[model samples]
Target chain A: MSEVILELDAVVKKFDDNEVLKGISLQLHRHEVVCLIGASGSGKSTLLRCVNLLETIDQGTITLFGQSLNDPRIDPDQVRRHTGMVFQSFNLFPHLSVLENVLVGPVRALKRKRSDVVDEAMHLLERIGLSDRAKEFPERLSGGQQQRVAIARSLAMKPALLLLDEVTSALDPSLVGEVLDLLRDLATSGTTMLIATHEMNFARDVAHQVAYLDGGVLVEQGAPDQLFTNPQHDSTRLFLERVR
Target chain B: MSNITDESVSEERPSFFVPRRKQLLVGRRGIVASTLSVVIFLGGLVAVFYLAPGGAAVRRFYFDRHDMWEAFVGNHNAGLSSVGIGIFTNIWVFLVSEVFILIFGLTIAWTRMSKSPVLLPFRILATIYSDIFRGIPVLLVFFLVGFGLPPLGIAVVSYQSVAVYGCVALTLTYSAYVAEVFRAGIYSVPHGQLLAARSLGLTNATTMRRVILPQAVRTVIPPLLNDFISLQKDTALLSLLGVIEAVNAGTIYQDTKFNSSGLVVASLLFLAMTVPLTRFTDGLIARDRKRRLASS
Candidate 1:
């Protein structure tokens, strides 16, 4: 069996009176791509945020690399260093150039040598086909370009797990294909990623396991073909029906 | 060239040509009307200045009668050898106070925004200082710091000149206002920028200094310049402390010579200094706005 890379047990998160995540449990094994498919405000984003320790859980526990992330003693910053997250808005630092955005994680936070880090960042930018635009700021790039750079920035950290929060939602329809293609490439290359997306086809095609979330509840989860072709839960079936 | 009918040509050209022709016509009419009104207003102002109570003689004396001119334009006593030296003193004080205000004001603003529980007291103190200093008139601060602090037998404050006391007073007063301006700038930065920085594992301090502050300072430049202009004008209030800055020198000349032209000259000089700064700030804001529009 593949060793578990991340585990969440009955994790609950609340914002004021709103209970966003209710007793959510999931496990991600090494080199596994898990896609969380849900409607808007269904707590998919909140769950991913919790895994990254961006949002504090009110109950239960989250363990990353077998260390309890819920424990107050464990620094969130350290956890984030290992777990990369790409947002829906593609929140690249607008002030920094494209190359600097990719370089900052290793150079600034990890205290890596700039000369060593810049080479790696340049390689990442090159792989993403953005080497020529390295000097350009985020605002100067198209939406697809910015999103791709954000993904590259996240990957620059060499994270154990990458969490994508509906990364293609803000992208134009034409732009979505390039980002998805990038994500697919990452998935095939055995990168462990947990994605929250509305794209059913993307989940079915790229995900090893497809989990459906409804109103903070994990409805059902299985291999993508099984879940898409033969959903066990009515909620999952209904969701797939509506999305198709 | 193959099918150049009059109707087709008219159809193609009217969309571009009609608007251009109409705008040209309207612009010509507007310029004529505006120029005529301005000429009429100036003529009326000239007639009033010469014909009204106190007439041309009063205007000439305060503006620049030959006798009053000497008192304003020539050598003067009360520590101002000439009007140039007096204006120079004011400019010197302004530069000194401005440098200190930006540094200390941003520091105080950061203190107000400190999230650490350990800094609760300091935050409270900063907030109180800003509120009280902003409430009290700057002139009162000049009076208190210039006159009040020295008489308590404090050696350090008592030793400085009246000009030094005035600089200290202005710095203390304006730093409070500038701190709030800095705070507003800090707040104006989008929350997403900080979130993105923190999510990248950057410490709060690093995120603030690198990501938040640079953007915030850029966004707040116009407002900061506005506060700076106010600070420039407030330097005149140092006259209350008997500093021989332009306003004080002007007042001394007015008192000894019994002519108001000295004060008028000082006013003109101040306008000459501040108007350019105001225009520069407006140009900066326009460029910033245009850049934003282009990027968006």
Candidate 2:
């Protein structure tokens, strides 16, 4: 087996009186793609947020590359350096040009030289087919284009793990294909990714592992084929039926 | 159905359809509205100048051309400076105070927004500073800084020039208001931007500086300009401290010449500065709205 890149041992999270994640455990190995499938408010987003350290977990440990992320001694920022997150809304800095948005992480956070990062940043933009729109701000781009730039911005950091939170949920139906196509390409290239998505077919196609979550509990998880064809839990089967 | 086909054939002539009539910059309705506005404005002026009781006396006292020009040029015999020149003092105080207000306001806002345990005490102090300053009337702050500070016998606080006192007073009072504006701007930026920045491994301070503040400052530009317009006007309040600003110069002329035209000139000077700024701010707000509408 490949090296374990992320390990979640009975993770728990709560907001005030309501628990969002209930002792959920999962694992992802190097160069693996895991798609988290759940209904809204099933704690999928909260789980991703916990792994990114945006929200602190209430119980259990999340080990990233064998480092205990919940340890008090670990700087969250330092841990975040190895992981990149693309948000649902594609929250690109409105004031920055598209190229500058891509360059910001490497040049500003990583302290990489601007000249060194600019070429790579442009190449990333080129790969996203946004090199012509590099000088324009995010507001000028279409929703799909903005989300693609957002992905490119994260890729600029060259993170060990990428966390995508419903990245296509905000795009128009006509625009969803473009973003999903890009994700398909990324999956083919073997970039380690943990994506929380509603696209069941995409999950079935691209993900090596599909974890079905229902009401903050990991109902069942296995290879996509097994999980989709033969869900062990009644709740997982019900969810799949409802979604289909 | 036949007419529809005819319309489609016409549409195929060219993608662009030029209207038969030239588009008028001002329509007939616009012309009528403008004419009505002009009439009402002229009527109001006529009533003020001719119909009101004491119109002649008021005009002689307030709008005497000779006294206005004399006040503007200054009366050397009276040892008083020109109101025009005195306005420069107000401008200088405004410029210096604005620089300090912006710097101090941003610092206070940064201190308030910080989440680190290390900044707790400083954050509390910042909160207290903004609360106390914002609660007090600006004029009271002016009095306290202008008169109270110099008596403290501290070397840095004991400035002899009333203009220096004015600058300090304006900076202290306006910084609190401006700090709140900055805070509002920061909060107006979506939380996702912060998350996105932090996820890139940027520290809190770097995220704020690089990602948050740039966006925040853009959103707050109109409000900031509004505060500045108020600040510019409030510089006239410094005249009470014997700073010889435009209003003080006008009053000096009023006392010696016994005509209020000098005060009129002072008001006109203020209006000249503020009116353009007000319009510019409105233009910015309109442009911002248009841009947002287009993008959304």
Error of 2 at A59 (Å): 1.0
Query: Measured against the native two-chain assembly using Cα atoms, what DockQ does each of the candidate structures obtain, in the order listed?
Result: 0.53, 0.57
Name the top TM-score candidate: 2
- Fill in the DockQ of model 1: 0.53
Local accuracy of candidate 2 as per-residue lDDT tens digits, A140-216: 89999999999999999998999999999999999999999999999899899999999999999999999998899
Measured on C-alpha atoms, candidate 1 has an lDDT of 0.86
* Ten contiguous residues with the weakest lDDT in model 2 chain B: B17-26
Q: Residue A157, candidate 2: how far off, in angstroms?
A: 0.6
Where model 2 places Cα greater than 4 Å from the true spot, the runs are B1-40, B279-296
Model 2 lDDT at residue A240: 93
Please give, for residues A125-217, the per-residue lDDT of candidate 1 as tens digits: 988888998887788898999999999999988999999999999999999999999999999999999999999999989999989999999
